[model samples]
Target: MNNSSKAVVSFIVGAAVGVAVGYFLNSDKKDELVGKLRYQADKLKDKWKKKKDQFEDALENELA
Candidate 1:
């Protein structure tokens, strides 16, 4: 993409992040939101690790 397009995308992402931060800072349920986010992140991490291990096992079997 062109420089202008990159700049626009960056600005949009920064604005979105700023808005989310402002919401969390002002909201009373910040702890709940954080807890949910952490739970989801952990779930995703576990899934990724499982998939990675499965892939490695398959590769090892194929090589052997």
Candidate 2:
């Protein structure tokens, strides 16, 4: 929501997109790389979900 937070999210999304594009263009062993990327992405999503909830709660407390 805030500028800094927005910037961070934008950077992350941009990096992921860039990596995906590179991976598609460069990968020879597609299946193995896809599996690894999926696993890593899932891990990141889980971590992000935990942190996002914490940030929301903190923001709510600040507002309250």
Candidate 3:
């Protein structure tokens, strides 16, 4: 898939997984659950950031 399509899929999948994890951990070990969710979120954030930077660099190179 294209980069944009891949990014969207990644976000949607990450959100769904986060929601499921939250639902399952709503009752017990809330702190642990939140930590796990945060970790996953950070990972996704990093992935998106990298992709965005790559796209920006390519655009800049094309414009130069």
Candidate 1 lDDT over residue span 3-36, tens digit each: 9999999999999999999988899899888899
TM-score of each: 0.63, 0.50, 0.56
Best by lDDT: 1
Off by over 4 Å in 2: 1-28
lDDT of 2: 0.94
- Give candidates' CA RMSD values in order: 6.1, 14.7, 14.4
Q: Which sections of candidate 3 miss by over 4 Å?
A: 1-28
Q: Tell how far residue 20 is off in model 3, in angstroms.
A: 14
The residue ranges of model 1 lying beyond 4 angstroms of the native Cα positions read: 1-23
- Which is the winner by TM-score between candidate 2 and candidate 3? 3
lDDT of 3 by residue, 1-64 (tens): 9999999999999999999888777767788878999999999999999999999999999999
Over the stretch 1-64, how does candidate 2's per-residue lDDT look in tens digits?
9999999999999999999988777878787878899999999999999999999999999999
Q: Cα RMSD for candidate 1?
A: 6.1
CA-RMSD of model 3: 14.4
